[model samples]
Target chain A: MRATVIHAPFDVRLEELPDPRIEGPGDAVVKVVASCICGSDLWPYRGDPPVKQPRPIGHEFVGIVQEVGFDVRTVKPGDFVVAPFVVSDGTCPHCLAGYQTACQNLVGYGQGKADGGQGEYVKLPYADGTLVATPEVPDDALVPSLLTLSDVMGTGWHAARSARVKAGDTVVVVGDGAVGLCGVLAASRMGAERVVALSRHEPRQKLAKEFGATDIISERGDAAKDAVLELTKGVGADAVLECVGTAQSMTTAFDVARPGATVGFVGVPHGVEVPISTMFRNNIGLAGGAAPCRAYLPALMADVLSGAIDPGKVFDSELPLADVAEGYAAMHERRAIKVLLRP
Target chain B: MRATVIHAPFDVRLEELPDPRIEGPGDAVVKVVASCICGSDLWPYRGDPPVKQPRPIGHEFVGIVQEVGFDVRTVKPGDFVVAPFVVSDGTCPHCLAGYQTACQNLVGYGQGKADGGQGEYVKLPYADGTLVATPEVPDDALVPSLLTLSDVMGTGWHAARSARVKAGDTVVVVGDGAVGLCGVLAASRMGAERVVALSRHEPRQKLAKEFGATDIISERGDAAKDAVLELTKGVGADAVLECVGTAQSMTTAFDVARPGATVGFVGVPHGVEVPISTMFRNNIGLAGGAAPCRAYLPALMADVLSGAIDPGKVFDSELPLADVAEGYAAMHERRAIKVLLRP
Candidate 1:
């Protein structure tokens, strides 16, 4: 099978790798129908020193089960399914509490005996607990939407939920990436009365509105904070979704929240140190981590299936599996909001 | 009027100062009935650079309103009241949302036209919002309990509430000082099934149990963490109340929380920086600030008036106004859990 592999920084290749097998009794071999490059993938692709061993790339996918190990019970061959980026036993205390990402026996994809979700065929462990099967094969048009349930959409939901978004809330989304756009959708769907999307890019700003942004701020840093504060009548927003994990973005999220408001962040954090005293004095509530995507898959899948949401619109480009390198380039060059790959 | 003054580090003196009077439409002059030396007083009294002007000390007290500016409507002369350490306008959005401490027009006690609560008379700003009136004059025996309602007890309640303590939660109070003992009481009152108090002080450990600590751990730092983990079947506590503002206490609070648990902290933070990425990944929630004591005042007052709780036990020593310096010394030397002063 050909899969996306990173040999080093800025070097992505579609390499011929040995096909995956169901070695674990709870594993299933999936024939991936669609996969998408993620923002995190760009971390290694854009000049971070790579590991000595080639790394498998991508974790978001929608696929059909080609085969399952003898003990796999919940899902079987010929079923269309979506696997959350992280696999959990779904029986541990944390998983039972709907924080599957923190499950004691959690296994992240693209590692261990499993191949990347971007591959033509991949082995998914804990098949019974990790895979969510659709009632039947989804319409080809809904494949992109289903693929998002694997991570980004679930993450967006996590951000909104963590912030405790309620009806009549004024929400602020701090980034305009695909995840940020999805946050706008999630906040709106969660009944936020007003959602302010921050963006300087005209294209993303337009898409942001389509995804339920009631307002848009083009400035960055202090100026952006001023705009949000002004729009909120100086009270600040009731909920803030931090989709970018930089210190600047985190600070803005904290600054733009009402005294008792919460900032729900799902961005992969890096080098962010929060001054606890400031948060304490301001009465700001900070909640969110890696989204327990598995916990939310059931509900979000229903929304996608019923056409209540169209998060797939964020996929602005699509390419064949062999052209996977170009897919990364398109996102890296800002030529695509998100790239979908057909295997 | 006599008041405790900090002329220099370790130089607490009972000084003769001009009596306070109502100076604004929103002001009231309160004749203090009882005031307690707080842990925070030691900050300025122990080696902090002194100002040219002597600083009036203390922010915790129960008092009687002696006079009010014409516009002060909530309480009149002869009303016994408890003032939150911070005064707020009460009409701001933050105050309406139960975060009075972060009110847009926040005026901390002891500043502006007001003197500290420790003085014989204090000119309080935002009188209606800052002072909570008791049904009548509280009994002399209840003076210490009522005084605690002004700050420490209210702060402990804030910590328990911020952590979202539920009926079945196992709570850990991470300090054994007066405030920490109060937190154990708050958590237990909030219905935590098991309350753990961490302290190495034998006397404090005894008081912690009387205040509702089901378990007491005499270990500090890592050893304390191991004990808490062992007690919780290695899952850590569901809610942790951080009553000490030091880095060591703050870190211990985080270390003993279960995944998806919350840490409620109320001590005035001195040098605490939180590792956001680690908190993000762990799904730990951090909440609580300067207590918003005014918000919790009414409910807590009812609990005290009905004799349902007795936080006055923390005031193990008492001093006359002239011995104010000795009161500070007793607390600094740990010879008293809390020192009550009468002017």
Candidate 2:
């Protein structure tokens, strides 16, 4: 079996590795069908977060169950399933509260012994609680869309929920990546009357419009805020989804939100100072974090299966698993909305 | 008429000022029976905030309406009333939504007006919306407690409401000033099972206990969080009311709150940095701001009138109007819980 590893800054290698097997009572071994790159993965790849070891790279995957442990009841051999990037025991208080990402037994797939979908075979614990069985083995034509539900699509959905984007809400989604593009779709699905996507890429903006972005602002700082104010009659957006985790993007989200609105930040923040004085006086709510992807995969998968939403449109390029390094470079250079790797 | 003027940092003087008259169709003139110094007044007094001119200092007051404008229909001359520190028109969209502090027609008494309660008389704008009339003049003993319904007591109640303290919640209040003590009373009134007061002062802690604080944490930082977590079976407090707006207090509030709980902050935040990263991941909802004093005064007045709560005990000192300077210094040095200055 071959797996991608980030050995150092800007370095990715396709290394051969041994296959996995069912290791625990609640565990199941699955053969990866498809996997993809993520923005979060870039943190380590760019050396912003130092790599402690040659780390197994990919998290998102849709696969077929190869084997199951004695206690695995819901999924079995040959079943096509969407395995969440992070495995969680679904019975904890936080999990019951629908915050599975914060579950006590949470394990990030492919980060450690949790070897991820970048490999041909991976062991998933708490299979009954972590993996969702599809109606059938989805055809190759639908693989890209189904694979996105593993992380990005559901993450975007989580961002929309955090901001409380309801019907008739004027929404502003900040970021042009796959997650941000998917957020536009999620906001539209949740009935936002208008969605303004802030993106500089024409290709990404085109997809954003298709996902229900009513407007676009390529400007930064004051210009972007002025444009939003003009569109909202000086009231600003009812909800702002901050999909890019940077000091500037967070500030833009708050500046473009109306007093008493919410800024849902799904981006992993780095070098950011959250201005409390502004948040307090403005009376806005801040909500969002690492998404509980497992919690949302069910409903999102249903939408994909029913042909109501095509979140897979975010994957603009696809490559064979053997050339995963090219996929990483393309994404790092901002050449792809998302890069899909067929395992 | 004479009013107290903040001439400079640490300088206050009683100077002759012209008597105020009704200036608008929705205004009235009131003969101030009582006016008190507030913690917020110190911001301009100490010059932390800009004080361009000698400004009138008091905002909290109870008085008798001496004159009414043509459109002032809620109360007439000779009516005993509690004047909300914030004068709201009660007819704007925000006012209708119960956020009268953000009213389109808002006027901050004393702070914004040339004539204020520090003088013998003050002009009240949006009088019908800002003044809550009593059926009759109460005994002199109830004056202090009733006056509090105009701001401090009502503001603390606003904090408790924003935190959503329920019947069975274990609430932690940060701050030991009049507002924090009043929050203990408000939390009890809202049916919280347990209330913890974070204070080191013996007198304020005693008052907090009287106001239904089941526990007191004299310690701060990690020790305080440990105490709260131990009390809550290592889960932290169900709700936290942040009545002190410093960065340390906000950090403490977030540290001591249970997952998915809310923190209501009523104190004017000063140099506060909210770690929104922690807040988002923990599912902590931060809600609060300038208390819509007009919105909560009615309920607090009813509670006071019915003997359901007594907020007057928070006043540890009282002084004649001429001695307000000393009262302000005492509160600034933490030597007094709150002071009532009688004019």
Top TM-score hit: 1
Q: Per-residue CA lDDT of candidate 1, range B27-98, in tens?
A: 988898988888988888886545456778788887889999889889999999998887788888889888
Q: Residue B140 lDDT in model 1?
A: 92
Error of 2 at A49 (Å): 1.5
Any runs in candidate 2 off by more than 4 Å, and if so which?
A135-143, B50-53, B73-75, B89-98, B103-106, B111-114, B132-145, B164-167, B189-191, B280-283, B298-302, B305-308
- Worst lDDT 10-window in candidate 1 chain A: A46-55
lDDT of 2 at A219: 90
lDDT of 2 by residue, A108-220 (tens): 87666477678787887888878998988887778888998988998899889888899999999999899999999999999999999998889998999999999999998
| Per-model B-chain TM-score | 0.97, 0.97
Positional deviation of A331 in candidate 2, in angstroms? 1.5
Per candidate, native contacts kept equal 0.72, 0.36
Which is the leading candidate under DockQ?
Answer: 1
Q: Kindly give the number of clashing pairs for every candidate.
A: 0, 3
Q: Which pairs clash in model 2?
A: A110-A114, A110-A115, A110-A116
Error of 1 at B309 (Å): 2.1
Spell out the clash pairs found in candidate 1: none
